[model samples]
Target chain A: MNLHHAPSSTPLVEMVDIEKHFGGIRAVNGVTLDLYPGEVVGVLGHNGAGKSCLMRILSGAMIPSKGQVRINGQDAQIHSPHDARDLGIETIYQTLALADHLDAPSNLFLGRELKTRFGSLDDGRMMREAVDVLKRLNPNFKNLSDPVSSLSGGQRQVIAIARAIYFDVKILIMDEPTAALGPSETAMVSKLIKQLRDDGIGILLVSHDMHDVFELCDRVVVMNKGKNVGSHRIEDVTKDDVLSLIIKGQLPDDWVPRSQETVQ
Target chain B: MAETDRSPPLVGWNLKLSASSFHKLSALFTLACLIIVFSFGNPAFFSINNGLTVLLQTAVIGLLGIGMTLVIITGGIDLSVGSVLALSGTVTGLCVKAGIPVAPSMAIGVCVGAACGLFNGFVITKMRITPFVATLGMMLIARGVALQLTGAAPISRLGEAFGVLGNGSLFRIIEKGANGFPKVVFPGIPYPVILLAIVAVAAAYLLNRRQIGRHIYATGSNEEAARLSGVAVDRTKMIAYTLSGALAGLSGNVLMSRLITAQPNEGVMYELDAIAAAVIGGASLMGGIGNISGTMIGAFIIGVLRNGLNMAGVSAFIQQILIGFIVILAVYIDQIRNRR
Candidate 1:
């Protein structure tokens, strides 16, 4: 795959030596990953392989027991989802993280609500903006006032995407973006990922789908049992090599690890 | 997959009158029917004097219902409101008897109520106690404190000026008599009714148009999702409980002023009435659904039934049973509408 950034540029996000312990269980133990501008990095792992746990720490849902997360080479302190939003980090959780009873516009502007001069919620202006962003993402989208619980799964996913892109997002973390979607909806998401990547946004895509990683990711990192098995360019490693690494946490004898002069 | 097939719009614009509003309209209809039937039962029930009297009687419960609406919308219960009302009244009565001005003394009463609410919020949020248990404990503690303060007796003999707040009417007309002396014409809307109206309007604005209102609803609807979306769930819940407490305090003062005394054992089982008013007006106990107009109508419904039944020679015992049945019927209807 073609490199999106020059080697001299600093990585947008660097999480080094991350460790997370839940009592006796070390969910994530000593893993490191780097993401650069305009690149999609796929994190592939089985259930309980620590992919979700590691990403949760970066998303500010959980704090790292031992690790340093640097943004633009500067050490950051993120203790909550509010702090993460201030640093332009938005996470689209697998559950979608939406209040099911609120309307479309209310959910789209849940945290970052726009207020009129008189200090009331600018519902009219918010509805207009929601219409603008949602139409571009899903042209068939309607019912701006209906509760999100009444929406279809694909439409709800589009609303969640609208929320992330509606703000000034620098780093987007998506956990299983298409896990519950149909084939057409999945294709729609793949198209959206490419569109966002081309627009110079850094994304951390965590999934168990091999085809999604091969088609949309530039670099793929495999994790097994809380450890990084290997990292390779999508073009350098075949589907079977990545599969073997994910299952056994072992790299083939003939395969060389990707160079990391720029990563460290 | 046939998953692409969209369900025919379950809520159309014509039918888009949300289930909440539809329930509100139905409640209004029920209230109108009750008035008509009672008026037929007794001619006095249809008079303007009786209408004003019913509203005056509803003022205390209406105030409590305002706070109850907020608490219920956040999916929490405040069983201590009635007891807090008694405590606030006793505190204010003591302050007035101690030579403090009535206005500031009343303000102190409301503040005392707010403090109790703050304690309840702290216990529920920081201490991680469930709201039902926390407020239930507060109910007993506040009632006990009120009883201890008054030594199981009522405080009375407050000055005449203190009674004006609850008994006076707005816009009283004065006319020059034949001998050039001012003469009383008409007594306008009662003070407590006007106060209830003002509080209801303010609470409605806060719930429908403000940021905190959204936070309260979101927190009640799905707390984990709200937290992940950057809402201050703890702060929102605290505010709801605090507001509920303040309103209860205000109600205590109004009731005391009207009766010209503060009874240590007053407001017993009053919490049940406040909760009933909210539920009857369409505020779901499950939270994330309610409105002030509905609650006000609900308060009036209870007041009219009680007043009209007394006039019609029905015993208070039967009235209680009927009100209880009405509460159950309202919730059951809400459940059926939601299922559709």
Candidate 2:
């Protein structure tokens, strides 16, 4: 298998020959990917296609059995989520994993709460930062004080994104962010993803939504049956190519397809 | 524009008022109801002396309840507090018998209590033992140790200075007698009562204003989330247990000083009383929501119920039964309010 290298760009994060196994089952085998600065890479796969597993390894939620992870050309030893955070890697899980009882500011500051002179939580500062971050991500988000439980799915996603961005995350891993959202919410998330890319954050987004991949992601990496099948630029590949990779586990060798559909 | 019109203000003045008032008013409502019931039932219930007696009696349990409130808010229970108290009192007795100074003996008692708390914390956090189970085991062990230390009997003959903690008044005043009657008035501030107040105030400040206090709530509310957020979950849990144990020890020592004896059987049912006080004060058994003030009120409620029952000629067994019912009722009320 020939590997293409984008040598002009210095990748923000690179995983070389990554291998992870759960007991006897090989979850991810010999997968290598690079996320460049200001790029959103879509990881497309079916259920149990090792997409989540690979992302988990990247986020340091789980350790890879073999292979090395390098951040900005430095070897990274990420054994836990805290270690991931130290490296500016943050993950927003499908469950969102947010504390429902806490309001936005509290959730944003969770374990690393800002403290006042008296050593209590600096609520005013946290609130101010939360507001500023939310406005930059989505100006329509106005209810910053309400408990996340009371917010709509879209609002919760916005808060989650805001949390990662405010922490100055260099690599953001989002798992099925729009899985439970409506069309309008999906659009809002798409817009947020674009904004995050513009801020030069490297994002690894795992999703089943082909439309989201085509619309928001600069490049798409297709995974099938626990292996990296191929990576394609959005400009060079069509939706049919991605779907074929996901279904047949490989791109067609010689299929000429029509091009230049109107850009929506 | 349509969406903005539909959405309510993030936080309205009325909504904030209602939320704060809801908790304050519920506590007020319960207090008012308790007063009205006791006043109507017994004419002597509201007497100054009777009130002072109730406060003195509630002080020890109130101190334990404050600690329990913190522990329970962190989603932990300390069933061993009663046993820890007995052990602490026993240690104080042994110290005095061995000719240790009264003040130092008292300090040793408190240190013993803190040791018990540290042990409980270690077992729960490092060993990953459930708080209830670990404390239950510690409770049995502490009780057995107390019994063994005292030879399963009462140890009397405490130092005079120690008695001042339980029985002696801080101040005394002479008043004029009416119609050739002689009257002597002692301020009637028991040392335990004073200590209880100090501890309660300090606990309230710690729980409500300090970063450690916030960590306790965060740990109790959602432990995994707390850890992810960088709140040391194990350390917070350890602090709660240690505080609970130390206070229990203090309560035991005070009880012994008041009675002028270390009775092995004295603290047998004290844990129930402390737990009831915490629950009655609105500290949820599920944790992450409680305060020292609420716990003090709960201790008073228990004290009043016991005092009122005695005045009304209720048997001791019946008083226990009534208290059990009240605890269930208070917890039920808390559950309903939380659901809303």
Candidate 3:
């Protein structure tokens, strides 16, 4: 087991040599990655490249077959998504997971619905809160009472992000945040990512779109076929260099995989 | 991905119409049209006597329909509800015959009904059986077991208290008639009607206000999404089926109290009527799209249709055909609405 010790500046989250296998298929091979506070790290890869698989393990949506997840320099247990959320980790899935029949506040607080003194849903208070949060994310937004199904794609994305932040997120994982969005929606998401990073949350974003990686990310981590090739500062690398790493799973001349490998 | 999650039906002139309100309005409109047509066909259909009768008759099915709405909204069906009702009535009858007190006997019957529902929930959740097949199997098994318990004979000899629970009225402002029959000075609420109203109020509050209720809707709308969000999908479905069974049991008790007997064959096909009322009220078999008030309206529609047709000299066989057609029509409308 790879244990992380405290330095007060330890990365917000560290995944040490994670491995996941499904029957004969090794979906995500041994991979190590770290997320620091107040930085946006992009995971770039082709389809089926295990970008989602790695993030899902970190989010506790799926368990790693082998690895230790250290939170704030201490080993933490993440058995389920609820546990992940309780530890101040939230994930914005590509599917967007909104209850289409529910209104904005309802979708924003789906499982963790706010309750009144009598234990009933406090819709009035929830709507008031939803209005406050949603307005800051999208200024021209007005349909707080409308069901999410009728909302535009960008509005829905805003709702998803608003949900995570409202829950007091410390580490945010976004999978393909702008994959289904138009240009305006993409820009909105990009802006939201930068704002979240500025607010001191560690963000792990998975994307295939090079524009989103360059526009919103401080650093890019490329993976191919379930293995992390390397992590690079965006300022030090060009788009083509990262593209080559993603397509060929090649390591940079000075870069090396994290020092330790887990024993079987 | 954008459209995959938006499965709730959309209607024309519906962009502003929240799906729940739209369905409620359409159901109310249908109920109104049915009432007007029936009233025109027979003037007696609009009379106070017939109205009371319709409301009273709506009690049994309406009670089951309330529970059915909850179950259906979770995207599951309880075909065993009618059989569970029969079993509960038979258990109550057996208790009374064994010298048990009337009140406790009925409570035992209701508990037994809840137990039956729990069993259904267990099979579906723990054993991983599809609800349709599990409840279908339970329907057959429960009816057969109920018949076996009673030796295929109806239990009679229930006393005066039995009559009181089923036929008693609230606010005793009545004078004894010439034959010692009670004649009311004021319109009073029947026990069954009172129970129906109380149940509907409580159910409406539970479905609309509570967290479990929200989880139910979430589970039905998208199970995987709900699970990921920390909603207990299995627990929600279990509660839905169990509540449905308990309601079916209570309806059966009220039914047996009125008849003062437990017939092994009683409550046969009652599930169909309850499901039909729920469907007519806009509860989707697909789940997550219904309300109890609309279900009550649907039950009233069924009651009016049956009473009006009978008053119009329509045969029972013809009434069955008409009901079947209405069920079909409601589903067809739902399909078109969902597609749009």
- In order of listing, the candidates' clash counts read 0, 2, 0
Distance (Å) between predicted and true CA of B144, model 3? 2.6
lDDT of each: 0.87, 0.80, 0.84
Q: Write the per-residue lDDT of candidate 1 for residues B272-302, one digit (tens) a residue.
A: 9999999999988987777788888889889
Across A92-168, the per-residue lDDT of candidate 1 in tens digits comes to 98999888778888888887888999998887788889999999988999867777887899999998989988899
B1-340, model 3: which lDDT tens digit per residue?
A: 1111122345465576655566667878888888899899989889766777787889999999998999998889999999999999999999999999999999999998888888999999999999999999999988999999999999999888876767887774779899999986655677899999999989877887888887778777777777777777898999999999999899989999989998779999999999999998888888777778878988988898898889899999999999999989988887787678
Q: What is the C-alpha lDDT profile of model 2 across B178-289, one tens digit per residue?
A: 8666566756666788888899988877875567876787777677766655577888888888999889888988889999888877788788899999887777677656
Give i-RMS (Å) per prediction: 6.5, 6.6, 5.3
| Clashing residue pairs found in predicted model 1 | none
Scoring only the second chain, what is candidate 3's TM-score?
0.91
Q: TM-scores, in order shown?
A: 0.93, 0.87, 0.90
**Ranking 2 against 3 by DockQ, winner:** 3
Off by over 4 Å in 1: A1-5, A253-264, B1-15, B173-185
For model 1 the local lDDT of residue B1 reads: 5
Task: Locate the minimum summed-lDDT window of 10 residues in model 3 chain A.
Answer: A255-264
Ranking by TM-score: 1, 3, 2
